[model samples]
Target: MANPAVMVLGATGRIGRLLQLCPPQGLHLRLQARRAQAGNSTGDWHIFDPRAEPAALARAAEGAAVLLCLAGPVPGRGGADADMADHVRLGEAAVRAGASAGARVLLASSAAVYGARGGLLAEDAALRPASAYGAAKAQMEARAAALGAELGVPVCSLRIGNIAGLDAALGGWRPGFTLDRFAGGRTPRRSYIGARTLAEVLAALLAAPVLPPVLNLAQPGAVEMGALLQAAGRPFAVRAAPAAAIPEVALDAARLQALLPAPLAAADPVQMAAEWALLEPEMAER
Candidate 1:
């Protein structure tokens, strides 16, 4: 018997880089990107754009048991109609390719879908997106789920929280960075997951027998921005929070917790910082 083959779309991005740095064992990984890069490893590499070459996805997913779609617009990408449509088409392609086999599709979604709604959000919480990016992701989840059901393909949308080194507060830090302090003198708090932990979670999901249509991906607890900065020994200034500042955006992981084999311990800022430190050398080279 062979290990499950997993096709990773958007293999040149942040999470992809993290996975490449510390990939899971016992899985045959096939990495796909929009084009060939100058310095990426040459193993199991496929070059094609899912947006322009949507039809090619069927061929790319052949014999793969999992199609992980990490290819989506970033914050500055505008998340236009065309950009959001790319996810739907990619999901369609995944379903089309997996129709014959018992393959499953995992679409990368974001907590942005929760928008301005503060507090611990659940999978069933009503979406109230405030930014264009959030709106686009919310739309993607709906369209992908609907299409997956219609085509009899098992689809799961991972509503991921802030990744350790990929978030604005920590990763985007610079000298004289400013943070918003709310009325109670508390800095913003958000659910965060370590990059290595994220990889483990994904690998676990791939090996699971059943999956929910929608699942929130994050460590057990939320961390304060101040604590994270202190953990990293980064300096920043504090400013009064604006009216639009959201104090917290946490995801309730009860449903997700029930699915995992062991408990995912609550997020620790020091631990998250340490995990990100392991990938800093590679990040600097990029």
Candidate 2:
């Protein structure tokens, strides 16, 4: 039998690029992008915006076991309202595409949805978004969940935590970068998942026969920002945390742990730093 096919929408973003380097084994990968990349001539890549081109999304989703929607407006490119609206449109398209085969639609959400909530948040926690981006994602989750129920399709919105290679602490590290030191003399901490580990989690979810409507995707514990920087051998300055700074955004991943076959990656800062460094050269070429 052929391997299950998994189509990744927005296959050229930060997480997507890392997945391209270390794709999951035993899954046939199909890619969707809004534009073409430099060295990709693979026939599996389809170029079109899912929000605008339903037919293209449908075509790309055919025969696929999962439609992973990673398409969204990154920070600074589009307004927060636009991000929420676009996700609703894309979610609708993905659900409709999978209506025939009942393919699982996994929508990429963010930890930003949790906002300034500073404790370990679970999948069922009440959303208390603190920023425009967080508000938009919270709204997006509600809309997408309702649409999935209406269409009778299995949809999961992954409230993803910070990805190691894509996060500000490691990926955004540069000389003279400033970090916030809280009154307790600690830096900001957040639940983080390595890019490669994320890919494996997605693959495992795709193969599973059952899934929840919502899930939190991250490692078991939160790692300190200062620790990540120190592990990467980067020097940085710290400033007193403003009153508005969130001390932590740790996620409760017990629900996720039950689903996976093995333990997730350690939340150790050095290990997370290595995960980020593994893709630097390839990321630079792209």
lDDT of 1 by residue, 197-269 (tens): 9988988887786799899999988999888988988998999999998889999988888999898999999
TM-score for each of the candidates: 0.94, 0.94
TM-score of 1: 0.94
Give the per-residue lDDT digits (tens) of candidate 2, residues 1-286: 9989988887887767776787777888788888887866854788988888888888888899888888777775565445556666776777788775568888888888888886789998988889766777777778777878888888888999988768888878888988999877789999998767887888788788778988999999998898888988989899999899898999999999999999785687888788778777888786
lDDT for model 2, on a 0 to 1 scale? 0.82
Clashing residue pairs in candidate 2, if any? none
For residue 161, model 2's alpha carbon misses the true position, in angstroms, by: 0.7
Q: How many clashing pairs in candidate 1?
A: 0
Candidate topping TM-score:
2
